[model samples]
Target: ITPASMTIVFLSITIGTIMTMSSSNWLMAWIGLELNMLAILPIISKPKTTRASEATTKYFLTQAIASAMMLLSSTINVWQTGNWNILELKNKFSTTIMALSLMMKMGAAPIHFWLPEVLQGTTLQTALLITTWQKIAPVTLMYMISNNIQPTILVSAGILSMIIGGLGGINQTQLRKMMAYSSINNLGWTITIMAFSPNMALMNICTYIIMTTPIFLMMTNMST
Candidate 1:
């Protein structure tokens, strides 16, 4: 990637996450999510290889679906509540749809079929960003909407993700796939904690980022 493009990508990533984290408005969070999504596609597709191209395509499609869901959920939310406030989510159907959309975006269980494939197809650095930084915006939104999300839904997704993450990793030989499962497992833990304590959810995410960074950095050049 050119220096200019790389700078924009990095800056967009920061802007995207901050937009979601700081915004009380759902549209602002969606904007941030879109910025983050658009920025990462170029970065991951920079490699001059077919796998990179395919990975980028798959990532784009998956995120597009998630983004569409997010937008639809927000639209319904506003229609019902006549408000765009993130915390004003009161409708059961809207809450469920929004929660599921964020879960899919974050690659949570039962809806995480895209994660391993994308992680395996992309370069280590891009995979790192997808597994770590890419989650910030969606997870932040999840926490903000935690109050409205059903406990049963959260617990179901969390347990299923943990099961899949754990079982899926046992038979994986590739490093990235294994790490992808590990990310899924950690996300499960985060979602579970999100049910009872938003602060704990954020703390778990912080700790996961801290621990995963050095490990992925070390694995950057270490092939599968």
Candidate 2:
């Protein structure tokens, strides 16, 4: 993409997250999320290497499914309650679907199969972006609907993510791959805390991101 195009894509990504983060309705949030998804694929594919191609394809497929699930869940909620509010997801089935979709989107277990492979194939910068930046919208929406989702589901996924993150990386050779699992593990803590306290969940995410910064920077320096 040209510099101008890249600028527009990033702008779209920004607009998407802003919409989701600031909106009252699920429609606006869903739209924003789709825009972010569209913008990110191009950014991930810019290198045009075989590895980059594979990464973008995998990411697109995974996110497409997750996005579809979000749309479905939100629409179902609207149908059931005759409301479009993000903060008032009342349908039990819809809430479950939404939670599962977000877990998939965030690469939390047992739907986390794509994260490690995608990270292994993308550039260090892109992988880092996926690990941190791309998480905000889904996690924010998760926070919004946290009260509606089942705590048992969140707790189970959180525990599994932590377990997998720890066990899967025991023999990793690539630093990026290890960090991918670490991202999953850190996300587990956030999800676990989400069921009881959104504030603590956000805190966990913030602390994890801060800790990740220097590690990613060091990896970047090493790569260069």
Summarize candidate 1's per-residue lDDT along 1-224 as a digit string, tens digits: 78987999899988998998899998998999999899898888888789888888988998999999989999999999899999999989989989989999999988899999989888888888999999998998998899889988998899999999999999999999999999999999999989989899999988999899888998975656
Candidate 2 structure quality by residue, lDDT tens digits, 1-224: 89999889889888988988898898889898898989989888888799889989999999999999999998999888999999889999999999999999999988999999899888888787888878888899999999999899899989999999988888999888899899988888889999899889988887887788788988898989
- Candidate 2 TM-score to native: 0.97
lDDT of model 2, residue 189:
85
Give the least accurate 10-residue stretch of model 2, judged by summed lDDT: 206-215
C-alpha RMSD by candidate, in order: 1.3, 1.0
lDDT of 1 at 38: 93
Candidate 1, position 191, lDDT: 95
Q: How accurate is candidate 1 locally (lDDT)?
A: 0.91
